[model samples]
Target: MSISAPDVTPDVTPNAPWWRSAVLYQIYPRSFQDSDGDGIGDLNGIAARLDYLVDLGVDAIWISPIFPSPMADFGYDVEDYCGIDPRFGTLADFDALLAAAHARGLKILLDFVPNHSSDQHPWFRESRASRTNPKRDWYLWRDAAPDGGVPNNWISDFGGPAWEWDEATGQYYYHAFLKEQPDLNWRNPDVRAAMLDVLRFWFARGVDGFRIDVLWHMVKHADFPDNPLNPAWHVSMGEMHRVLQRHSTDQPEVHAIAGDMRRIADDYSTPGEERVLIGEIYLPLERLMHYYGQDESGVHLPFNFQLIDARWDARTLAQMIADYEAALPPGGWPNWVLGNHDRPRSATKRGAEQARVAAMLLLTLRGTPTLYYGDELGLEDAVIPPDRVQDPRELREPGLGLGRDPVRAPMPWDAGAHAGFSTAEPWLPLGADWRTRNVAAERDDPASMLSLHRALLALRRRHPALGVGQFRLIEAEGDVLAYERVCGDDRIVVALNLGATPHPVILPPGAWRLLLSTTPDPFTDTLAPNQGVILQPER
Candidate 1:
């Protein structure tokens, strides 16, 4: 059956926080829309599409980095933290987007890059000018090893040594990622003070929150010890994974920094505007929970990426959800992400049908859920011909299937030329099935992927159980995953069939009201392959 997007007002308990159950939609700016036909999506283009996002029933949008940069690593290498890139329009454009989004009951979050600065940034320029420069200690600079080799054997996330030798300064500077991006010295008080002020600059402009980039990598081991080598390391996984990153990330002192960020966000929040800090941490649940801090003075949400890294199986996912639920610290809210720019789309990793089931799992699970762009259309990774590849990762490590360009394709808004994303060619190629898979085509078809997302999002808002409920695994075996979500009087039973052939689930006896089905029409018997449904007491 066709469904309209539901009213997304908070239906949880009166005092419940918005982000606790909020569904955030991550916008890759370059791919979202192009207002001026510059072959790139900009802030003005995003503002033009605020109505579409509101119709999608998401609570907020997390835009990827759009700061001024050389685009060496996209906008992650920030040259100016306070100013918007000329390509993304001026600060006036950002203000307009913020105003438009807020008018629709939606929040906006800017990507905050705190761990590093672009090598071209003024701070880095000064630091590299000479050893005695005032800003020299603002970044990590160390003398070469006794034999004149690079210091400490740390490898860059892109490729090669993390230390870059500067002939002028007679020192090597540390960069965790691309050499163009120099790691900032969070250990230095002046660096800490300046970065925190950057937060204030934005908060004063009325941004709702920040998704801090590489939050764990901000604080490294003080002793500069070499990370222990991993026995299972392979060259294909990138050179940085050669070690376990024990000395580079998940440090104990990072909690204090997280608390400081939370305090900064809290300071600007009014009664209506409860600002938040979401840390982009990739550690295991045990260590990831620490970012929440002991007294709830840390990040509001440390992104949970278990769904992205886990083996796509019924039993494995069931246990992962259970374990993650158990591991959350007191007062720590859980979050889940199916895909992002760095990873392959969930639809590509799993088949198109299973992707719908995965979407069901993401929206109905406990805590906040982040929906990646184009996921609602069952968009998979586009095949980027070698000559057309734009991602440096693929260029640096050829033929490793590590390139992120495929998933960063422009949004297929319509069947028009350029798929209504741009008048000129897109920065990255659109999915091959753009004509059939575009939003305009799917919006009219009752059984289209877009309809299923609308239905599920409607169900999540209509029932409190699915959003802020207590969870319990009901069954997990034989390619079937079942669970119950309960919130006082509201109880929802979600059953998912993971296998290709029809799988019968012995649902507990009850008068069941079918709330939603992954399929278009009502089902009478067993669930079709990759089908899932939400049921409530048929009272």
Candidate 2:
């Protein structure tokens, strides 16, 4: 089914500074909508869904990369930073999408991939032409070992050696991801200038901000030292589990570049407007806070991944929350993310019944919250058949189960053929239970998960404490997590039952008033299993 196009007239007035207190919806462009009957979603398809997104009460949309790529790692392996891939759409389609989104008060933030580029990129192509090319320094290249082996112990995110020997240059080029995606050499001044220009190109087009992809891997050690083998190999996530990643990625110099990027955002922001720059960093709390830099000048939001690491236990979650808040810089803005294109959906991670509870916790947290696509309807991960797997990581490391295809399934729009994603067969199949859990079916039922998401988002907007407030942990016992958000005159106490048993918490008499509850049961008496409650001081 084709996505119906919306009116694309441009808006003259400045949009509301809605991103400050608004929810940002993340769209995996390829799975969001299909307008050309090509089985894959395109820019026009996103334009068609702007109304739906606005109706869902999101103030901004963060689209995954649609840049020109070889699809080695989907659009993450960008060949041209300024151009859109034909699989997605042309430049005109993107302009139309931005116009349509702005008309509906929706700000747009495109994904910025500075860590690496496709081997087919012009820069990389020229860099690999010969050892003496002027652009040879644009990409990371190292000499092979004396035995004609890989340079170091570093492992590709997709498994095996991170360095691939280039016969043409008689040297090894580094690829933190698939071999087709070579890591850029940030040490080169010219490379940094070119990437900054790419940022300016999008900013000139009136983009609100950028979701910097793999922002931590932009720089590497100059000596190219070998990474020590990690003894705990099976504990890591994704393709990283295949081998130890010691010397290759996540170098300290990345912060200097991040600070420069922040300066660029500050330069672009108008007096009263905020131009956001968020980093995709997966690290411990102590290390994550450093990405914000010394004076809260670098990376407006470093993306707190505590929720991704915490289990369903109440005490464990409480500690994680406390640790993150404690480590945040004085004026640094905190951001919460429950799921993304790479990880498993929260619905599947936490059971179906607990998804709403998790959502309440996310929206009520004292920071910006990002919701992944299809998460509003509590969509779980789809089981990808082995024969149909397209992830290069899965193909390279069969035993490790490294692919992310299960979590990146097509979004379920309706209970139609291919879940109404496209008239033609989709690149990936829709979830099997799409008929029961979909936007169309949920829109018609007020009790559905989608409706709950809308109501909660609206509620979050109504309460100032949920957006910009001081978070204080409330005293609670086993299986119950409770916290109070206070902003000036507004004070809200949120309690969540992380387990499957009914839990009870003592509250001051007439001091608690039910504001929102994930479970259908009333919040006055006893909290049900897998329930969440937002309580305001009695009126």
Candidate 3:
């Protein structure tokens, strides 16, 4: 049964698309909450916490994959596209969560893994039945090279070659990530038609949008070719960086595929409804902009992760901001993300103080910002001992330190035996400071990270200048970066000192009042070391 449209009009930009300035919060389910004491999170657990999410002030929630899987690469290796994983919940549970979320005026976006599927999927099972099976062309399968070696020089993102030999068949199948995950043959029209129906299944179920994972990897060079060796490749870096992946990713054909996917999503729209499709692409800004498609026919938003890959200092960051803004297509809307399940927590990358400053920069920027779970509480990466590590990346490459276990730890809700996340031991251990760092401890503390986030969110809610205004760079030297956001008469100036020592902000002569600051009460012009502040009416 379909869910009713949200009764309350969402708190969104008056005349603009809802996603333009929406604050999206990502929930990694297993670590979010576990209601059954089974040491894993489920949909019911998420539904239980809907009120908390509302209070946190997010406009939408983007949950990671909850589809049925064999737990090989966690939920990324999906076995069923239309069913919920037994560990996560059943069909009814998801329907309940969707209705409850919409009732709270929060839009929900599901993670769509398009690049590959678990070897156990019904499609893959049927495709591998025989070389001449009716569905044999559903997946990418090629005969062994002339010398009987793996098909090509393609390397898996998880290390080793990208193909796995099948004993029952006289061929090797391609896999971009895990051998258990075989890439789909997207070039096949039948395959494309089948995948389009998958989008329809969820869209008809009332999902507000989809966050397509590995969007660039969906289409690859038709004739398999060796990826060029990276000039900057070093022995110390992850194996994925060893090749440039020129032929393996970001192919020209992908734009058309994206356009088709966007059209399917648009089909579900009603008179006043807009169903968004956000692609999780990590290509360069120049290549990234093309996903928008000609005539606004592609993805609604291709996630911009430049911030995740850039240096933490002001000079490098400022230039990246300018370049990103300049590179957007005429009608392309922008988005930003400070951290996600794939990367280290911002607090761990740049110390706690700077993390607070980053929060300010992310929330006050001109575009939409996606906040990963637990970052709002200033949670640092949990230390995962080698014996307790759960990430496949870390297990596959131990010495390279590619483990994502640290960042995927369970959320700490309060001071409890399991940090109030689960009654049983969590799948991944909780961070060490949960007793003091949990939500309960920080909600009332004026100087805590949680309080700071609430203040910033409150300010953004009240002032369109900070959330959806026009951004203009202000000339500032040294480690300080300054910019102005203006929405008619409601203009605000923001300055940040990325260094460890206090920096004098060179502002035009005027009475600039501090609207919000990382510092304690009684703000001033001299931004304390690693601090960010919001001011009004630039002279």
Q: How far does residue 372 in candidate 2 sit from its true spot (Å)? A: 0.3
What TM-score do all the candidates reach, one by one?
Answer: 0.96, 0.94, 0.96
lDDT for every model? 0.87, 0.83, 0.87
- Indicate the residue-level lDDT of 517 in model 1: 86
lDDT (C-alpha) at residue 300 in model 2? 84
User: What's the ranking of the predictions by lDDT, best on top?
Assistant: 1, 3, 2
- lDDT digits (tens) for residues 1-539 of candidate 2: 11111111211124523455668899999899888898899898889888889888888999999999989888999999999999999999999999899889888999999999999999998998998999999998989898989887788877777889998789999988889999999999999999988888988888889999988878888898877766665544544654444456678888899988888887788844568898998776787888998886688888877797578888888877776776667666668899998888899888888889999998988778999999999999888888878777678877554567877888888988888888888888778799889999999788888988998888877877776666777667888888877767887888999989888876544667887789888776567999999898887
lDDT of 3 at 3: 14
- Tens digits of lDDT, candidate 3, 1-539: 11111111122354567777679999999999999999999999999999988898888999999999998999999999999999998999999999999999999999999889999999999999999998898899999999999888888899888889998988999999989999998998998988888999999999989999999999889999989999999867888888988888888888898999988887887644578899999888888889888888889999999887679878777788777777776777778999999999999988899899999999988788999999999999999988898888888888786788899899999997898899999998899889999999998998989998988888888888877777777777788888877776677888998999888887756788888888773556687888799997535
Candidate 2: where are CA atoms >4 Å away? 1-18, 235-239, 242-244
Across 394-431, the per-residue lDDT of candidate 1 in tens digits comes to: 89888888899999999999999999999999988989
TM-score of 1: 0.96
